[model samples]
Target: MASTITTDLKNLSISEPVVIIGSGLAGLASANQLVNKYKIPIVILEKESSLGGNSIKASSGINGAHTTTQSNLNVNDTPELFFNDTTKSAKGKGVETLMDKLAKDSHLAVEWLQSEFDLKLDLLAQLGGHSVPRTHRSSGKLPPGFEIVSALSKNLKNLAESNPELVKINLDSKVTDIKVEDKKVTGVEFINTQNDKVETLNTSNVIFCSGGFGFSKEMLQEYAPDLVNLPTTNGKQTTGDGQKILSKLGADLIDMDQIQVHPTGFVDPQDPESHWKFLAAEALRGLGGILLSPSTGKRFVNELDTRDVVTEAIQIQCSKANNKALLVLGEGIYEDLKNNLDFYMFKKLIKKITLKQVVEDYKLPITSDELAEHLNQYSTAAKDTFNRPLVVKNLGDEITSETNVFIGEVTPVVHFTMGGAKINTKSQVINKDGQILAQGLYAAGEVSGGVHGANRLGGSSLLECVVFGRTAADSIANVN
Candidate 1:
């Protein structure tokens, strides 16, 4: 099903190649996979002048199944465990078969990024909710999520150089409408956001990877009103144009209410842009980090709970105190998050000598020692509680609140839409009425639905790209 050279550029005055709707990781992964595997022509349409949508701004790493490193640690992990954890975290709303497929493919995705793309993976620490160490981070200090996208982008650039006809990337092209005939996508109508010029391109398939609507205040209020105005770490370009467009096309949307709001989003009132500067990945919590409610002067639920659970806990803490809670982090927690900490957080840490100093200076009631004693005691108890209930030790006063407490803002910011055009396991995009539009109209990455059931794990999105990318390519190649 490789695309044929059906149209000549000279005769049609075509300004682009096979049209792609967004320049984010999903869009880029699709283009890179197609070009590298099939030598198909591609045209990436980006609304902004620069590349890197919310996908590039991500700080958390990607989650894959257990690796060789985990094997050495004697950490027993299987695809079944991965699938179970994901579905349980998502409250069984996620599709089990799809989760199973992704679980099996996760490891290969990690391997491909490291072996083929030269991306270094730090498999030492695992993220939240999982017992085994499966989260793979980028080596050195680069943010885990962005490093994967950067590697993919770099590979795409090399592919473009090696094969000039493979891809034609156009920046500032914002798609407004998708043209359809007999319920099948045929072309796209867009405007050059830079010059205010309109353009249209004919294509057999259209992929929407324009990111989620996290940055749009109006949409956030409309969709998840509960989390409206809570600080978000999402990129400004994540306005959910792709999800909105698909909704208009009568796609089966699932789980709009299930939003994953991370516990920590750096907030600085003076600089609005810095309000949601950077996020410390949930991995720190999984590694014994404590979550504190500074206003209430107490620690709440486990920080390692599923994102929604943590969000609810934070909201309750805020409401009970009649104000937004301030998050406290110990120096150990700060050290682990140093690489991905945003400018605001980095400055906050630099000015404060220790986690306790931060609380005293900011006039926050919580301190680090109190939070740490809680975590250390909890960690010791957790070892025996799940298997056998242990005698609880009181850790309230032994340690003062020295942990750094930043004001907590947990609202539903549009992060990523896990739902999209219906696609089979092989990644073939289907129509609204469950009809196959075209043989080669395949989709991978975030544009293809069913990968994530309701909510996604911290690092699973990037893994989806590589897993489905290769699957789509191979399926196309094998199809007659």
Candidate 2:
């Protein structure tokens, strides 16, 4: 039922056992666990009328080291290996202990979402920077972050209906301020979007699952000045409301300068405000796709480099090619690598009208002989045991004949901050004074920081939400 608070209720006081702000995966997962385990009466305040925050727009899947499917296919992976790979992906800056905890608990998180939450996942193809294949995703080739959030939202609603002592949801409500008393949080002040009414909710605990400040101009200027001029794909609501609150609360921040630039996001080269066209997943490159520079008509960088390296290389490739940027994919590549990749992303690009138009506009050499030579060189260079082939080295006038190669250009857009409200292993938000702010006040998901260190791995954000979400619940249940 669509519900709204009227002007007469502007000063209403809602007292709950616990109050959670934000309805993303982190908030929903933590609420679900808390209500199920302790029967805690919780109120979830969400700015959007519907659930799933920025997660609803995710185009990628969660990364994990589950051996269920990939292991069955003889792809060996262990928690230790997963940890090491994640650190390596972050250029050795990730917190070792934190990554270890995530890897160790990832299987259980996956299990809970699948068995208890009714979320589905398929093994996603490994991308550049990892030694083994371990991405897990839902159907729709859509980002499983959305699926997980949607599933947890349903669970929250069900719990609210059946267990009167458990969770309650208030949508179209924005948390305007957090009320603090004597260094302890007492409640939150929220404004209803449907009407201009404001209400104060008193609670013993406050959990922030609001996402990063990807869409906040001030945050971009402060943390990621280099990307201030580029395009972004983050949701408008991802303006990092939680970060602003944490900053005001004097929370210590880390890695605010380290930002990941997703290279495949299609943005309007002319207008920066245009929504990021869905990014072709890096999984595509792992499945024999190619990254091409339209200016020089050549490929560059191993498609599998960490996002930083790939984005940097794309910039170099485009600069070298006279500032022209575009990507290409061979038709046969989809045929051979489709079954091994996300089919939705595959079909989206497979039948892309822009691709055909781009190909036509560039007048790329598509003859049988030219194609065969390019394939031979690409095949020869694509032979990395741990890395994808750097396609720029393989494209030549003499090369031609067989093999399909998909190419894409660069966005170099700063998407989100990898750092914010510092938290301990228990997901307790810590103050700059080196003490926990409140006994029951916890944070999960992107709002809680210190996990991704300098750079985040491909699918670790969602995994962080679920893993820490559960841990935060356990901690909150134990809170006195």
Candidate 3:
């Protein structure tokens, strides 16, 4: 790997550093590997004013198999089981090899972060479509995404401080074009948003981690037209800039039409019509929260079902109603999720109240007697008639008029794009013919796809960023 760096884009005489587009987890991971492990000079460009793209907003945790966190909890899990669960969740649309790679490296990815940065991921939970507990997060008030990104960002800043010429990170620099020569990427053309200046710099490699297009109205309309009108939980910086630039270079995109609509975006009563939504983490349901139809106050779908299934059920129910559903968490669940509950309460997205109080406060149609009967029925039943296990064994039975529960209005929102530029196991961008399109171009994270097919599991997004981001760095480092 090249170890020379040019501080200014105007200096054409100096050798170019390895260029990483986007400062999200994937891009930061790549840079970390390249500079720390390979001792390579690198430059990271981010379109946003701050670093950590949509990754910083991730509420759930990262998935791992047979991790130290899981082992400590006495949970038995393997990569094969994780693979089966992922493939099943993907619904036969995911690429088999990519899924295999992701599952196989799941443990190592978790360990890498723990060993390298000493980030705590001691808590484990079972998300939907998973048979066992595997998603790992720290037992802290701060979410996992913030912990991981902040740690990585601090590490990178330390590297930059020590070796100013070797590591450079420029915020508000957006890559507009890939400069290719002889069918190989050589550099990039970008605009410095601060000064409105256009510049070009030569580089040995370009790793695109610019992220998905969920927030892009034009891209959504073009690819998944049905999802254009839906609200998104993605950051504004996720406008498919990397995909658009790569596609122009003839990179074949796969599954662009497959978008994942997460079932639980908090519909703020203060601004119910806004398209930008704060995602209610899937862990909320995983931790024994139940979804109820606001009109009738009854469970409409299995809360632990796959996200797509739950989202479809919510959409259908909302179509008949006024696009409203209720997420009810028992006292035990609220106690377990005090951090998130307090935040939601501060945002006025959720309220702490008794069952009877909620009914009266929200003007629910169910009578107090009927609501008590319904809760008793759920509590006494071992499992639903459909054979789906209840979310929590004694959740419903524990609810009482004096018991305080957290309740929030939720609706389906556009969450993840399961499709983007096609890539091989090495994270090299490829074409439709199964051929590498550019020798010096690579991609990872949500910017490059085919890993998750029809739907993505709750915690796999962060795992994908770490696993493939490191893979891209390794591939680029090994390049002659």
Cα lDDT, model 3, residue 480: 47
Q: List TM-scores for all candidates, in order.
A: 0.82, 0.84, 0.95
Off by over 4 Å in 2: 1-16, 92-94, 139-143, 162-165, 268-275, 320-325, 330-360, 363-372, 380-410
- Top-TM-score candidate index: 3
lDDT per prediction? 0.61, 0.68, 0.85
Error of 1 at 238 (Å): 1.7
Off by over 4 Å in 3: 1-16, 386-390, 393-397
TM-score ranking from best to worst?
3, 2, 1
lDDT of 2 at 30: 83
Alpha carbon deviation, residue 74, candidate 3 (Å) = 1.0
**Once superposed on the true structure, which residue ranges of model 1 sit more than 4 Å away at CA?**
1-17, 182-185, 272-277, 320-323, 333-338, 341-351, 355-359, 362-414, 437-449
Which of candidates 1 and 2 reaches a greater lDDT? 2
